[model samples]
Target: MKPLNITYIYDYANLQVEEVRGSNISLKNRLAKLEQALRNKDELAENLHVIDFEQLKIENQQLNEKIEERNEELHKLRKKTIVTVQIITHMREKVQFVQKEYQILKEELAQLDQDLGAQRDLVTKTKHERDEHRQEYASLKQQTGIMNSEHLTKDFKDRAERIKELKELITQLKKRHSQMSQFIKSHGGVI
Candidate 1:
């Protein structure tokens, strides 16, 4: 069927109304004209239905395009959310690693402090021992000095007594030799 044209139908209806206004028409001609108008009206009604159906199809297509656009946006959002979650998980892992390293360093620092304290204690004990040794050495030196002076005085006295005894023995030997020489001369024995 040919598509209905509104301008053509308006012109055709005006032409028919002008013809009907001439009231000298026969009954058969009027009946024929009414039947033709009725047929045009039914064709117009069918054409309006077709136009409405075409408009609904266009609107349906436009709605589908909007839904597609929204779906694409939703897909992009889901991808972005996944990437953000991955970044957050990586950051959490890094924070945990840093915390573990900090704990290890803290323990090492504590151990170092303990070692330093022990070294200080050892130094203090060594200083005390050194002081005690120095005092003992001083006391021993004073006692040794006194003992050496007494020994020297006793040796000098013993040497002076021995020299006196040797001088008396030499005088006795000289007196005996002079007496023997005089006796030989008095006896006339090769004096």
Candidate 2:
């Protein structure tokens, strides 16, 4: 049926019913008009249902569009989540690499500490040996002073031999220190 203004028909029906309630019009004529107005209002109401059906179609189309837009947004979010997961994986690898490097550095530091302890011990031993050599030299000097020329000459020879031995020991120590320096260089360590 063709669409028409339903409110106008409804209002006309209401006017007729009101007029019939208090007017001096003949009862039969008023009753006929009243019945015709009611029929017109019913027809208008049926036409109004077509408008409501069109509005419902528009509303359904809008809801479908909204659902499609929401689906597109969800896809974008899913892609972003995947990218975030990749970044997190790369960062995790970096953290593991750093941890391995740190562990290696820690081990090297421990080795250096042990070497330091050994060096300290060597320094202590060298000091004690120096003190003993000093005491021996002092004793020889006193003996030379108290003895005759022949005995003094013998003491001088003994002192010369001891000096040669000390020189040899110093040479050995220098070679040992050189070897240690080479070892440090090979291991990427500074002496």
Candidate 3:
């Protein structure tokens, strides 16, 4: 080996110093990129927190509206219940009044039935008496034909005139009974 050259060694030492400076600059660029990335992440997290708070506020407002609607519905239902109860009470009173009226009408009908029965009995008794009077008049007429003397004939004529008057009275009684029957029929009696 020959002796080392001083100029060559000086050139090699300068080359090594330039390479160290380049490496230090590259490392500084990488550190700056990392710092920028960290700042961007912090900004994103802050924006997300603000969005979540806004969403929570909106949900709270919706819940409050639903509660108010339910309270209004409950108040309306309570008013309707009170009105319904009052109507039922009025209907019950009306029913009681109608029942009382019906009972009074039933009692009146029973009394009318009793009156009609008495009237029918009176009509039947009057008919029986008229039939007995007719039989007696027939017997007296037969006896009058058996008499021959003038005095007896005169007495028989007078008795015959009396019987005719009695027949007229019986006819009038029959007319009155017919009028009473018509009256009872027109007044809703079961004659």
Candidate number with greatest lDDT? 2
What lDDT is reached at residue 89 by model 2? 100
Worst lDDT window (10 residues) for model 1? 19-28
Global Cα lDDT for candidate 2: 0.90
Q: Residues 37-138, candidate 2: write the lDDT tens digits.
A: 989988887787788788888999999999999999999999999999999999999999999999999999999999999999999999999999999988
- TM-scores of the models, in the given order? 0.36, 0.42, 0.39
Could you say which candidate leads in TM-score? 2
lDDT of 1 at 128: 94
Residue 17 lDDT in candidate 2: 81
Score each candidate by Cα lDDT: 0.87, 0.90, 0.87
To one decimal, what is the Cα RMSD in angstroms of model 3 from the true structure?
22.4
Expressed as tens digits, the lDDT of each residue in 65-134 for candidate 3 is 9888888988998899899899999999999999999999899999999998998898899888888889
Candidate 2 has its poorest 10 consecutive residues by lDDT at: 20-29
Candidate 1 global TM-score: 0.36
Backbone clashes in each candidate structure, one number apiece? 0, 0, 0
Better-scoring candidate (TM-score), 1 or 2: 2
Off by over 4 Å in 3: 1-52, 123-191
Local accuracy of candidate 1 as per-residue lDDT tens digits, 1-191: 99999889998997887777654466667888988898888899689879988998999999999999999999999999999999999999999999999999999999999999999999999999999999998888788886657677798788888888877877887788788888888899775
